[model samples]
Target: MRRNTRRRPTGARRRTFAAVALILGGGGLVAANTYASAGEGDSGGRVQDQSGGDQAATISCPDVGQQLTDVPGEARADVDKALANLDQQITEAYDRLTSTRQEQAQDGNFVRNSILGPLSEKRTEVIGQIKIDVKRAGGTAPEALDGLAACTEISPAQAQKNDGGGDGDNQDGDADTANPGTGQDDGGQGGEQQDGNGNGAAGPFAADFVDITKVQPNVKAKPRRTGDASTGTFSVQCGVNENKVFNTDNLIVAPGVDNGAHHTHDYVGNQGVDAFASNGDLANAKTSCSEQGDKSSYYWPVLRLQDGTKEFDAEQQGGGLEGNVGKILQAKEAEITYIGSPAGKVVAMPKFLRIITGDAKAFTNGTANANANWSCTGFEDKVQLADKYPICPQGSSVVRSFAFQSCWDGQNIDSANHRAHVAFADAEGNCGNGFKAIPQLTMRLVYDVPAPVIENGQVKNPYAVDGFPEQLHKPITDHDDFINVMDEDLMDEVVECVNAGRQCGAGAGEQPQEPQQPEEPKQPEEPQEPQEPQQPEEPQEPKQPEQPQEPKQPEQPQEPKEPKDKPAPQAPQEPQDEPELAPEASSADADKDRAKKPGEAPDAPSEASSAPSDAATRTQEAGAPDDARGGETKARTTSPAETSDTGVEAQSEETQPQPQAGTGSLASTGADLWPAAAGGVLVLGGLVLLIHNRRRNMTTN
Candidate 1:
C-alpha cells in the first residue's frame, strides 16, 4: 500500500521543482521552506519522507553504480545520454501516475498502465540502442542486456482467499486483494463529530494511527525464531561502527517516485550500495567488515525517538514527525548467523541474492504489519505488543531481530514477488521439501536509547520508528535488506568451513598485501640470547675436567674424541643453522632456497623468524590494537634489517674468547695418546731382549 498523494517531484525534475516552488512562493522563505526534490534531500543519500509540512519529493534515475558496466568505453557516452533521457521520461510518467488521490496510487491496475508500462517502454528503447551501439563500437553485446529492464516494475494484485475469514494461511501469498488504509481520513471524520463536545484527538498516535493490535496480531502471538543452535554453524558478531555506515538520499522502493516513502536508512558492509546496486557493484565495494571477501550489503531504516514536543520544519513535512525525534544512534552490534543444515555444509550463496525482512511499508496499516518483529534487548522471549515500540533502559539496548527466507527453488535467484522463490526453513534449519537449503540468514540489531517513563499509568515519550512508506506511522514498520556479493573463492571457503563445522571470522580471511617485518624484533632478541648462552655452557663444563685426569681422563678423552666424529659436529651445525633459516624461509620461498644450501648458515633467518612470533605474542597480550595484526603479520616476513642482525650475532660468536678449559682438553688428549703409544713399544722391546739373554746363558752351562 502507498501513501496518500500530493505533488512530489521525480528525480531529474527535482531541480526544476525546487526552482518552481521558489518562484511560486515568492522566494520570501529560506531554502528549507521550499519542497525538496525526489532523491535530493535525505539522510544517507536515500529518499524517504520526513514528517512535517512540505509536499513529498520523488527520485528520478537509478544510481550510476547500479548501471550495467558491460557497455564499452566508446559506447558509454551514448548509453549515459540515453539513460539520462530515459530517467527524464520515467520520472514524468511517475508524476502523472501519482497525480491522483492516495487510494488511486495503491490501485495495481492504475499504476501498471500509467507508470510502469510507459517506463518499461522507455527502458526497452534505451537498452535496444545500447545493444546497437555496442555492436557498432566493435564489441559483442553481453547477454545481460537481454535480461535488463526497468528496476521500477509494478505487478497486478491477486489477493489470497482465506478459508477462515481473514485468518489461517491467508497471509502467505503476495497477491492479496485486501484494501488496507492507514485510516487517516477516518480519524479526521471522528474528530469533527467529537469537536462539539470539546474532545479533540490529542495527537496522531492517540487516534486511529495507533492500532497495531489489529494489524500485527501474528507477531504478538508468536515471535519468530532466528538463530542456529547446531554446532559448527558460523556467526559473525559485527561490531557497530557508525562512522563507516552511510546515509544516502536515494529511494529504493519506487525508483522514479519522488519521496514515495520518506525516511532514512543506515547502511553497513558494502560501501558502493544504492538501490540499483548490482552484483558487480557489491563485488567491487570496499566493506566495513574485517572480512574483505564478504561484500554483502546490509541496510535498515533509521530509528527515531519521539516525545510529541518539537515543532516541524518545512523540509520535514509529508512524512515528518508529529513529535520530537531525538538524536539517532547507530546500533551497538549486529549479530549475524549463517545457518546451514548438518553442520559445516552451508552451500555457497548464489550471487546477488536479494533478501528483505520485516515490512517497511506497514506504517499504521494492520494488514502489512503481520510479520513484524519487535522486542527489548533483555526481553527477547516476551515480545511487546505491535503498537508499542520499546524504549530501552539505561545500559540496556533496544534489540531488533530479522530472519530472512532461506529455502530456494534452485533456478531463480529472484521472482516476480520479491519472496516467491524463497521459503522459510524448518525449525531445524533444513530446507523445505520443494526447496533446497541456501544460507539461512539472521541478524540481530541492538540499539541504545533512553527508556520511556509511565505517566498516568501509560508509557510516554516512547521511541517511534518506521520505514520509507509514508502511509504507515508506527515503529512496527522496521525492515532491512541484504545482497550477497561474496568473491567466488571466498564463497567456496565459506561453504567448506561451515559444512565442516569451522568457526570462521568475518572478511573470510581475505588478507591484505604482505607486510614489512615488525619494528619490535628486539623483544625476541632478549630471550634468544639467553637460550644460546646455555647451549655452549653444556659442553664446556664437562671438557674442563678432562685435562686434569689423563688416564682417568678417559672420560675427558672421550669428550674431546667426540669432536673427532667430525660428521657428528657437522650434523648439529646443520640443525642449528635450520632455526636461522626458518625465519627467512617463513617470509619468502627464495630466501628459503638460499638458507637450505649447505654452504650458508641461516642463523640470521632463525632470529628473523623468532622475532615476529615473539612480537605477535607481546602485541596480543597488550590487547592487539586494530592494526596490530597487520603489523604482526608483516613483521613475521623476513626483512633485510633482520638478516643484518643475524650476521652480527654470528660474527660475535666467532670472535668471542674461547673457554680455556675447552682448549686445554683438546691439547691434553693429544699429549696423552703419544705417551701411551711409546710406552707400549718399549715393553715389547724389553720382552724380546730378556728371551735372547736367557738362551745365551743356557749354552755356557
Candidate 2:
C-alpha cells in the first residue's frame, strides 16, 4: 500500500538542498516585503481615510494576554510591567482620539498613524527592554513577546525585526517566530523569508520542522462529559469520505464555502466549496461523509513526506513558496463528525457560523503550542518526541487530530469573527461563564506513512513533510476549521444523537440504521407548450379583460416551458452549478440513494419549492427517534453525565497533564533540550540516528 513519507534527509545532501532552494515564500516573502517597505508601506496597504484630521499621535499596544500564554512566574512581573506602561499610554491616546468625536475612533489612518503606529514603535522599544530583563534574569526572551510588534491590524514598524533593524539574530536576517495566536503568518505574510517574530532563521524547505514541543497528549483516561443531559443529544455520521480532500489552499469562509487557502491544506466534506460559499450554498451542497443528513464541512493542511530533497527551487521559479514544494501524499482517512444536543428546542443556527480549532499562529511556536499532535495510529498512548517525527510500526499510519469548540453563546449562533460565539467545554464538559453548552464537533485525520526498513540490522525511517526549515523543526503544520451550514432540521437531528448518548457511526457503539425507504409518489402529468396557432384566436374576444386573461393563460402555459427551454439551451444548465441549487439537488440524490425505495417517485412536486423546510425533509427522516434516553431541558446548573463517541468526550484535568513551571536552567540556553549535549554524545547520537533512519528507509523502499 502507498504511504505518506515522513523521513528527512541528513548530512551533506540535506545541507546542499537547503543552500539552493528559495527560502522566501508564503509568509516569509510577505514578511520580507513588509520590512523592505516598512518606512514607506502604509497600514498593510489599506488606503488611509483622509477624513480624520491629524490628532496628536497616541500609542496603543496589544493586550498582553493575546501575545503570551503561561509566562514563567519569574518573568511575568517584568513582562506585565512593560505591557502595563505601554497599555496605559495607548489608553490615554485612545481617550484623546475619541474624546472629541466617536467617528475618530473608526478612522483607520487616524488609528494607525496616531495610535497603532506609535504603539508599534513603543512596543519594539519595550520588547527590547524585556529582552534585557530576560537576559539579566539569565533567561531568553519568549517568542510571543517578540511577536508583539506585528500584532496590530496596521503596524508601520512591521518589518523592523524581520528587516534587520533590531537587535540579535532576528535583526541579522534570521527568520522570526510565527505570529502569536496564529501558527502561520497572516495572509500577507504567506512566504518563507521571515518566520514572523523571533523563532529562528530560514533553513531548507524540505527539512523537517517541528512547530511545537512535545506536550502531554490531551486525550482523556476515560469518557468525560461533553454536554449536559438536560439537552438531548443529536449526532450525525458525518462521513469518512471527502469531497475534495486535496493538498491545496481551502479555508471555509462561510458555510459550505471557503476562502482560498494560500498555503496548501487538506479539504474534505462539502462540494460547493469556493471562496464565496454562503449558508445557502452550504445548505445546498452535497457532502462526502456518511450518507446521513449532516453536511457540515471540515478541513486542515495536508501533511506531506519530504524525501530528503529540495523539491522546488525558489530561484528557478522567480522566488516563491512553491519553489519549496515537496511530494504531497493522500491521507488514509479523514473522519469528521458533529455530535451535540441543543440546550432546549433546536433553533436554526444563525446563518454562516464559522469556527476554528487549534492555534494557527502558534503552529511553529515551542511554548504553549496547542496545535501539534504526534503519535502512531494505534499506539496513540505513546507520543513520540516533539523534535522527532514518529517512525510508526509497519501497519499504523501517522495521525493528526483536531477537536473543535462546542459550547455556543445561545444568543448568537455566530460572532463577528466566527469564534467569539463558540468556546470549548471546560474539563467537566460545562460551558464557560457566559456561554451555553452545545454539540461538540471533532475531526480525526490519519495518514499512512511508508513503513520502516532495516538496513544492516539497523532500523531507520527517513521520510518527512515539507515545511520552512528556518522556523519549524517538525512537520507541525496542522490546523482545522469548520463552517456549520447544516439545514436547521438536520442540525436538530445531530442534537438528538448527542443528547441520547447513543453512538451512531462506524466506530460508535450503534450502527447507523439505514434510512427507511419512502414509497414513490405518483408523477404529475407534464404540461405541454401552448401552440402558437392558438394565439390568433385570443384577439377575437370582445371584452378587454377577457382578452387579456386569455393571453395570460398562454403565458401560464409558458411557465411549464422549462423542460423544452432548458433542454434546448444547455447554457441554462449552468444555474445548476450555482451553490444555491446544485448542492441541495446532489445532497438530496445522495439521501435518495440511501432512503428511497426502488422506482419510488422523487419529491418532484416540491422540486420547485425554495423553502428550506421542503429541502430539509427530503434529506433527513421526518421524525426524531423516541427510543433515545435523555431528559428534556432542565434547570440544573451542575454538569451532566458523560456522553458522545470516544472521539467527542472532553478531557478532564486528571487526564490532561499540567505544564511544568519555571524557565529553569534550560531557559538560559537557546534550545529546549534538557542540557547542552557534550560533543562526543552529540556526535555518537547523530551517527546512530542517521544510520537508523537510513536503514529504515532502505528497507521500506
Clashes of each: 51, 64
- Tens digits of lDDT, candidate 1, 1-701: 99878877554355444444434333322222333322233211111223311122221223221234345557655655554455446445544533432433234354445556667677777778877887887776656555455534221100000000111121233323122222222111111111111111111132211211122212111112122312223444233433223332222333223233344455656655543444554566555554556667777665544432221111241123211133334454465656444211345678877766545434322332233345553344323333334444333455565656656777665542245556654333445556765655656565555555432112244455634322223444456677777777867765655444334544223211111112112222333333433432332221132122123212211221222233431232212112121222222312213212111111212111111111111101011111111111100110011113443343233223212111223344355344444544444444454455456556755
Runs of candidate 1 exceeding 4 Å displacement: 1-231, 237-241, 244-252, 255-261, 307-326, 342-345, 363-370, 382-387, 391-395, 426-430, 454-460, 506-701
The estimated TM-scores of all candidates read 0.42, 0.41
Model 2, 1-701: lDDT tens digits are 99969767655456334333323222344454445444322222122234422222222233333434234446645655564455444434444443433344345355556655666777688878877765676666567677766423312122111111112211111122211111211122111212111111122211122111122332222122222332222333332222222323233322212112323444445644444345666677666544335556665654533333222221221112322233334443444444443222223454456766543322223322223444554434323222224555444555554556556677764442234566654433445557665555555455555543322211223334333222232334345677776666666666565444334433433222211101101101112112323422432221122111122223222222223333321122112211222234434433223332111112311111121211121111101111011111110011112212331211222112101101112232223222223333444445555566567667867
Q: For candidate 2, what's the RMSD?
A: 26.4
Show the lowest summed lDDT stretch of 10 residues, model 2.
516-525
True lDDT of residue 568, candidate 2 = 29
Off by over 4 Å in 2: 1-260, 308-324, 339-351, 363-369, 382-388, 413-418, 451-477, 505-701
User: For model 2, what is the C-alpha lDDT against the true structure?
Assistant: 0.36
Tell me, what's the RMSD of every candidate? 41.9, 26.4
